[model samples]
Target: MARYVEIDDVRVALAEPVEVPPRAFVGRDKELQLCRVAWGISSDGTELVDSSAPPLNFRLEGAPGLGKNEIVYEIARRLDMPLYIVQGHEEFTPEDLALLLTPDPEAVYGEVPPLTLRASPLATALYEGGLCFFDEINRVPDRALSPLASVLDGRQYIYSAMTGMNIGPRDSAARKRFRFCCALNPSLSNEGHVLPEYIEQRTLPVIEIDHPPFEDVHEIIRTSLSPSPDFLVAFTDWYYEQERQDISVRQAVALMNYAMNYEQHVGGQKTKIFDQVASFVVGRRS
Candidate 1:
């Protein structure tokens, strides 16, 4: 069938999904390399399709705001394919993983509006050989992930009851190009998130992203806020020491940002802005 075939009352998006590069994906070259390996790619830009265990899936584990989303953005840009994203949460349901039939935007309410099959990222990636990133996947409940187990396992297909379609790579070339990966927050478990073991086993290389080194963190701050003062970098790096486990690259940037917004309180003293940000926001969590 054609990529954009209209089957029955449903219309599939045959064209590749849109891909936008991340504006400031700072660190994690090593993590990106591991993801490339999981996707059957090698250091020298060769495909390892014939490997003994050729599985193109990954589960990226890290604390919130440690640049997990940024890694996938880089991968999508490198692959030069369509990027599909599915956000996971407590209320995530199996139906959310398939094609959704919604009122067509082009049709008005009075007219007989054709229902458009708002295809899920899972199905879109499978159909068009693209990258699918499941953000905060651990937040999704056990039942919601059942459909995912089949896709990740030897079955290599997902049955969308909404569209009554079994979505998978159309041919060998499509299969070789499609990639799937997930980002998970370590704290989600504490928030009562349960990852189904079947899905866990199907996934490989649960890569853990720890905080970047002091130097890297400093550089990230410097590069992120070019023409920034040296004191800002020194102070931010020092603040990081106070919350080794709690702080992240994102939080550091926020502090700089918060400081800038609270500049009026500093009376034009740039360094004093740091104090305002630290003290202004209590119970700060990233």
Candidate 2:
């Protein structure tokens, strides 16, 4: 169920954060440290030297499936805050970033106002001081992202014309706690989906992430797959030795998951299982 909060005299349903079960997170220590530094968070989890300055908003640039979202999730988990995510798309509008009007389920037909305002994830984060991540930000049309200027800047708020309201932190504490981050593929820059200069300017200290090393990948697979197969070592070695395009962490996980399922079904020999998974998962016919 969605929770409701009163913002500027208007009742708005807060957007729920993305939820996933706790899992062992592997590697990306450098990237995680970079994000922590950018956010003014210290090694001990305390706000750094200047508590008065609001945390800087940063953008994570990486290829698809490279654990960009996982980085954000890890940060939110460490901070123990709600993580509101707004998935970017080509058709997003300014209003979509702030508020939307939906038919009121409880309103009496033809008697009371038929519409209720719901806060978007970003707006809910702003109002409630939660962490908000805009994924694949480059996919959102430039026009739809115009409203983010104020929200990302020192002003630290967004004005919604629909309700004629300025939605932001309710108090100093909320302002201090509120944080924002975004992720997008830099490759999209050449594909007519480049970020606006102002946006690029406001979202500072851009963090560039690449695929994790093989050792980390091995750890990820070992940790993610419970009671990992004994042949996992052979499979990882084969994957690294193959002269094929590098797969993202997600693809690697998927491959291992398929291999586990295959093992369960066939109860095959180790070598055969590896061959089948490699052939099916990576399109390499053994």
Candidate 3:
């Protein structure tokens, strides 16, 4: 059952505890342990005070599709913290971190001006001490990210050009208590943008996630396909070989599910299903 916590006297839902299927994640015991430790540091005030630690900020960096976001989702789940997601892109602006001009409910008449507004999504979430996930952090431009330096440092100061106001120190001490975590793609020649050095310096406890081992991959396939164990074993074995040749686990899962569904829809024959999967692996499908 979900639990509720009072934040600024407003109650928010804390998702119910659920069993984390071993298949969903494999290997990386050390990384999992580290995440758990960081979560404990953030959630338990007694532990934080004893260790003289502030909210643990983490930067999870890895190759694309390596389950970095999944780790963050799992951590949030285990900690029972409210999650707010922010997608970083070239168009993102400093206003994203500050206040946004949302529709005002207090506006009179059926017509409301777009100029009339409310707080930004991040600020609103932070006002309630919610966990904000900055997805693809490096994709956001350096100038756009400048405003977040203070916020990441646990200060909530934000300059709003729209209202010509600098609203923050929301409750003073607690204003500097929001937790920030981020995920970024590993810097590559093809990557779109680079994170500033200053922003890099502010991030702590950098964690890197690598692809799971072959056995773990097989387990993920099997567990995800538990309803059809026989087909799962065969499909996993076949995809395990494909993975050795550089196929992604995500593609493997997708192909397997597609093959199974195709078989069900057209005659329920294993031979036809295997052929469909093979075509997908070979990139022969139209």
At residue 202, what lDDT does model 1 achieve? Answer: 73
lDDT of 3 by residue, 1-286 (tens): 3233443343333322223333355555677667656544444222222244565667888777667766766665655555667778878888777666554444467775334344554554466555667888888888988877776664565565555655454463444345577888886415647778878877768888776776766666666765377676666566554444344566556667777777778755563466556766546423
Cand. 3 TM to true fold: 0.75
Candidate 1, 1-286: lDDT as tens digits: 2245454445664434656755665667788778878887666433444566666678899887678877777766655567889889889888778666766666766999876666677877776667788888888888889889877776677778766787777678767677789888878777778577887777777899888776676777777766357557546654754454456778766766666666635455665556546645434545
By TM-score, is 2 or 3 better?
A: 2
* TM-score ranking, high to low: 2, 1, 3
| Candidate 2 deviant stretches above 4 angstroms | 46-50, 105-113, 227-229, 283-286
Clashes of each: 0, 0, 1
Best by lDDT: 2
lDDT by residue (tens digit), candidate 2, 101-216:
97765676777666778889999899888889999999999988998999998788888878888898988778887889999998888788998999989898899989788878
Which pairs clash in the backbone of model 2? none
The CA lDDT at 236 in model 1 is: 60
Clashes of 2: 0
Question: Candidate 3 regions off by >4 Å?
Answer: 1-28, 39-51, 105-116, 154-156, 167-169, 172-177, 187-192, 222-225, 243-245, 267-275, 278-286
Worst 10 residues of 1 by lDDT: 1-10
- TM-scores of the candidates in the order shown: 0.85, 0.90, 0.75
lDDT of prediction 2: 0.82
Root-mean-square deviation of candidate 2:
2.9
Candidate order by lDDT, highest to lowest? 2, 1, 3
